[model samples]
Target chain A: MSDAYAVRDNILTHHFSDGSGCIFFDPMDNSMVAATKPVEELLNKEKSESDEQHCHIINTLLIHKMITKL
Target chain B: MCRRIYGDRFTHSIQPSEFIDFRIGIKYPNFTRRFLKPQVQFSSEGLVPFTPLPADYAFAMLEWGMNWTVAMYEFQRVIIHSAVLAKDDYAILLPAPPGSGKSTATAYLENNGWRLLSDEMALITKNTTQVTPFVRPICLKNASIDLCKQMFSHGTFSETAYKTHKGDVAHMSPQRHSIEEQSTPANIVGIVFPQYSKDILLDIYPMDKTSAMVKFSENSFNFNFLGQQSFETNVHLIENTRQFELHYSDLSEVNAFLNEEFCK
Candidate 1:
C-alpha cells in the first residue's frame, strides 16, 4: 500500500457497491474514465504497487490527470 | 395534421393559467415558394432554426423543430437521446443511436402495455433517478413505419413524409394513457442498450456499472453542459439501475425479458 498518489481535486469517483467497477468524472475536461476493480483498488491505495498491472494503471491515471502525486 | 397526430393534445381553447412551453409555427417560407415547388419552414419565437422542407414535410419538420427547441433550451434537466418507457411506475431508459430499432421497439412496447414517457428523449431531473414524462409522438423511419402500422392497426399515425434525410419518416401518436399521465414522473429502474439484429433471437449481455456509465453518457444530449451535476446524476442513476445490452429481432421476446427482469 502507498499514499504517494491521490485522486485529483474536483474529480468525482463512484465505486459500485457490487464491486463490478468504478467510474471517475473529470470536471475540468468534462471527461469520464471507467476502471476495473483492480484499478479501483489501486486508486483507493488498498493494493500493492508490486503488481506490474497496477503500476500501469496508476501511470495511465496519472497521465490523464485523474490522479496526482501526494 | 396536428389534429390528427396530437388528438386531445390539440385545442383552440387556451387557459390563462397554462404556461406555453414553445411558440412555434409552420408556414410557407415566402410568397412565391408557397405556389412553385412549395416548401414549409419551422420557426420558434419568430426565429427560424432549420432550412425549409418541401411542403409535404411540414408536419415532420414541426416535430423535428420541437425536439430541437427542447434540446437546445431545456437546461433544468439532463436530456438524453433515448426512449423512456415505464411499467409499474418504474422507468427504463433505452439509449441507442439511429437505426438501432429503438423507436420500433418503443412503438411495440407502448402499444402492448408499457406507458410511453417519451419516444425521442428522456428528461431526467438532476441528481435524482426520477424521469419526467415528455410524452410525444414516436417518430418511425422507413420500414419501421409500415411494420408498426401493421402491428398496431388501431393506432393513429401521421401522414408519411417521403424522401426526408432520415428516409421516409412518420410519427405514431403515443397511447392515450401516456399523454393522460404526462405530468407523472417515474423512478428509473433499468438501462438497456438495445440493437436490433435480424438474425438474433435474443441475446442479453449484462454490463458492469463502469461500462454502462460510459455508454449512457455518449447518448446524452446535454451531458457536458450540465458538468458536475450531470456526472453526479448519471452516477446515481447507474448505481440504482440494472444495466444490460440486448440484441434481438423479436419484439415479443424482448418485451417478455424486460417484464421479467425489470418490470417487477
Candidate 2:
C-alpha cells in the first residue's frame, strides 16, 4: 500500500485560469488555504517527503485538514 | 440637514401601507441629555445597537446605523466592505480598509461620470458576478472631508462631526445620476485595492487571482458565516475580474487610470 497525501473530501479547490495559484476551502473548519501553482500541483498528485518546502506544505495542509495521509 | 444633503432623493413619500425594511431613529439618549451635553442614540426596530454620541453626530450616526443594519441583518447577498463604482454597467470593486483613500477615490470617480454602486458596501448576488447598487452618501473622514469639499465645490455635505472614533466625519451626497439608477445592477469587471500614499503619485500592481481572493475575502462581512457559499462566490468574482493594487496620492491620476484600464 502506498502512503500518499490526498485532498480531504470536504475541501474545495479552485485553480486560477493563469496557473498562478490555487485556493483550498475547508468548510468543516471554515478555513481557506492559498497555495502557489507548484504547491497545488504537488498536492494534486504524490509528494516526496524529502523536500523541506514540500514537507512544510504537506504538514500545514495536514494540520488544516486540507489533506489526509493514506 | 437631511433635506439639504439628500436633496430630492426622498421626494416621493412612502405610503402608509408600504413595508419598511428598517425602522430607525436617531434621538437624544435622555431628557436631561437633550438639554445638557446633548447626546444621540441610534435605534432600529426598537433596539439600540450603538452607544450614544454627541448630538452633533446625529446624522453621521444615522448613516452608520443604516450601514450596520444592512451588514448585520442582510444575508441574502454576499456583502463586501468595499466601495463599488461602474462605467457603462461594468463595475469595479474597491475593497480596502478604512483610511485607505477608498472614499476619496470614489468621490472623484462618481463625480466624474462613473456611477456609484455604494460607498461602503458592495452587495453582490449569491454566487454571481452581478453587484447591486446600494447607493448612499459617501463618508469622508478628517482631511478628506475638507479636500472633497474644495474639489467638488457644488457637492452637498452634511455638518462635520469632529473628534469621532473615525476622526472628523462628514457625508457627501451621491450624484443625482447614481441616485436615479439606484435600482440598477452592474456586472463585476475588476477588483482594485487602493492605498493612498503621499509619496506615490500613482503606482499600480497587477494581482494574481489567489492573492486577490485572499485579500478580498478579508474584506467580506459575512464570509465566515456563509462558508462554502462565500468561497464559491468569491472565487467566481476573482475568476471573472482583473485584480490590482493601486497606491496613489492624486485623485486625478487614479481617475484617469481607472477610466483607461477598467472603464473602457
Candidate 3:
C-alpha cells in the first residue's frame, strides 16, 4: 500500500502568487513550512509510496508533526 | 494659531451621542503654577494618560489623541502604519520608519491630483483587496514644515509646535477633494517603502515578496494581534500587489515616476 499523508490539524495553507511556493502554518506546533503546489496536492492524496519524493516529504512532515497518516 | 488655520477642517458638534466610539480629551492639572506654566494632558476614556506638555502643544496633543483613538478602537480592519494615496482606484501604500519623509511625499502627491487615503493609518479590510480611507490631515515635522509651506504657499497648516519629542511638528490639512472622496475605498495596487535623502536623484528598487511581507508585518499595527485574519489578508495583498522601495529628494521627480508607473 502506498503511504498517504494529510496536513495535520490546525495547519493553514497560503498559495503565493509568484508561483514560488505556499506557506503551511501550524499554530499549535508554532511551525511554518514552505511547500510547492504539487507537494500540497500530494498532501491531500491517499498514502502512496509510488512517488518516493512525495512519500519522503510527507514522512518528514509527519516526523515534524506537520502531517498525519491518512 | 492652529485654530486660526485648521478650525474649518474639524467637525465641530456640540451634540453628545450615546453611541460614542472614541472619547478623547486633553486636560490640564490645576496647581499653583498652572496659569504660569500651562500644561496639557491627553487621555482616552480618562485612562492611559500622557505626560503634560506646554500650552503651545495643545494642537499636537489633539492630533496624537485622534491617532490613538483610532488605533485603540478600530479593530474591524487591519491597521497598517503607513501613508496611503491613490488615483483612479489604485492605491499606493508608503510604509516607512520615522524620519523617512513619507508624510512630505504624501502631501505633495495628494496636492498633485492623487486622493489622500490616509497620512498615517491605512485601514485595510479583512480578507480583501480594499483599504478604507481615514482622510485626516498629514503630520509634518521639523524641516518638512518649512519645506511644505514653501512648496504650497497657500496650504493650510496647524501652528508649528517646537521642541516636542519628535522635534517641531505641524499638521497639514488634506486638499478639499481628498476629504470629499473620503467615503470611497481604494484597491491596493502597490506598496512603496520610501527613504529620503538630501539632494539625491530619485531611485526605484524592486523588492522581493518575502522581504516585503516581513517588513509589512512589522510595520502593521495589529498584524500579530489579529493573528490568522491578519496573516491571510497580508498574504493575499502581497500576492496581488507590486512592491518597491523609493529613494528620492525631489518631490516633482518622484511624482513623475509614480504617475508614469502606477497612475497610467
Candidate 4:
C-alpha cells in the first residue's frame, strides 16, 4: 500500500512491502531489484504507456497539420 | 569472429556478441531470445531494454555483461560482486543500496586522487591484483549534485535525469586521467558497506567471507540468473578479501581516511 506520508526533502518515498515483495535499491545503478511481481509488471506497463504517449503525440501533430491546411 | 565466455567455456562465432550461458539467461524471464544465446552477434541497432537507447549504449551494455561473465571464468580467486574504489590500487569495495554513499564515496575518492575501478560495479578476474577500470561516471542526487559540484571544481556534472523515486539524480564524469592509466586486478585489501547518516562512524566491523558474499550478492545485477556460476564467483571474491561496514556523514573524512589507507 502506498502510504501517505510527509515528504522528506521534497521527495515522496513510498514503501510497498508485503510478505512476497522484496525491493532492493542498489547503489550500483538507477536500477533496483524488486522481487515483487508488481515491479516487473509496472516496468512492462510503463513501456506500453510510453509507446501510447508517443503515438498520441504523432497523431495529434498530424491532425493539427491537416486542420491547418484547410 | 565473436567469442562468448561462459564460466569455463569459450565459444566463438563469426558474429558480434555471444550468449551469457543458459543458466544465467533464464533468470530474467522478460529477456528476449536474442539476449538468451550464449554466443556473440554483431549489431548497431539500439536494442537496449525499455529506453530506445543508441546502438553505442546497447553495445556497451552487451560488452559489459559479456566481459563480466568472461572475467568470472578467468578469475577464480577473490572477485567481488561489489562496487570498488581504489586509491593507487589499494581499494575498498562499497556494497550497499543507493542511499548508501557508494557512488558518493566514489566521486569523493576520485576527486582526492584515487583511481576509480568502477563507479558502481566490480568484476574480478580469476587470479590477479589488477583492478580493471569500468570507469563509468559517478551518479548523484539533488543535494549531492550541488554539494559535489561546489566541493570539487574539477567535477563534471551531467543533466539531472529528473525526479524519480530517488529524487533528482545526475552523474559526474569519471576522471579521464585515471581512465587512461587504470588497470584491473588490483589487490582488494578491504571491503566496506557504506551508508549515509547524520554522523560519521565505522558502525559495522569486518564481516567474514561467507556473510560478505550473501550481502554482496543481494545487490548483484544478475546473480539469480547466473545461478551457481555467480555464486561461485562471489565465493571466490569473499575468500580473498576483508570486509567492513562504513557509515559516514559526508565525503570529507571518508575521503581522507580511505586515501590515507589505500594510497599508501
TM (chain A) per model: 0.69, 0.70, 0.59, 0.23
Going through the candidates in order, the fraction of native interface contacts each one reproduces equals: 0.77, 0.85, 0.12, 0.00
Q: Which stretches in model 2 have alpha-carbon errors above 4 Å? A: A1-3, A38-40, A44-53
**Each candidate's lDDT (Cα)?**
0.88, 0.88, 0.81, 0.52
Candidate 1 structure quality by residue, lDDT tens digits, A22-69:
777788888777777644466666556477766776777788899987
Model 3 earns a TM-score of 0.81
Checking candidate 2 for backbone clashes, the offending pairs are none
The ten-residue window of minimal lDDT in model 3 chain B covers: B1-10
- Model 4: share of real contacts kept: 0.00
lDDT string, candidate 4, B94-138, tens digits: 777767767667777777777777765676553343456565556
- Quality of model 1 by C-alpha lDDT: 0.88
DockQ of 2: 0.81
TM-score, model 4 to reference: 0.55
**Stretches of candidate 3 exceeding 4 Å from the true structure:** A1-8, A11-15, A20-70, B1-20, B31-33
Best by DockQ: 2
**A1-70, model 2: which lDDT tens digit per residue?**
2346678777888888878787788887679888766444656555555667666766778889888876
Give a tens-digit lDDT track for model 1, residues B1-264. Answer: 899989868999989999998899999989999999999999997789898999999999999999999988899999989999998688899999999999999999998889999998899999899999998899999999999999999999999999899999999998888888899999999999999989777999999888888899888888778888888888889889999999999999999999999876
What overall lDDT, based on C-alpha atoms, would model 2 receive against the true structure?
0.88
**Deviation from truth (RMSD, Å), model 3:** 5.3
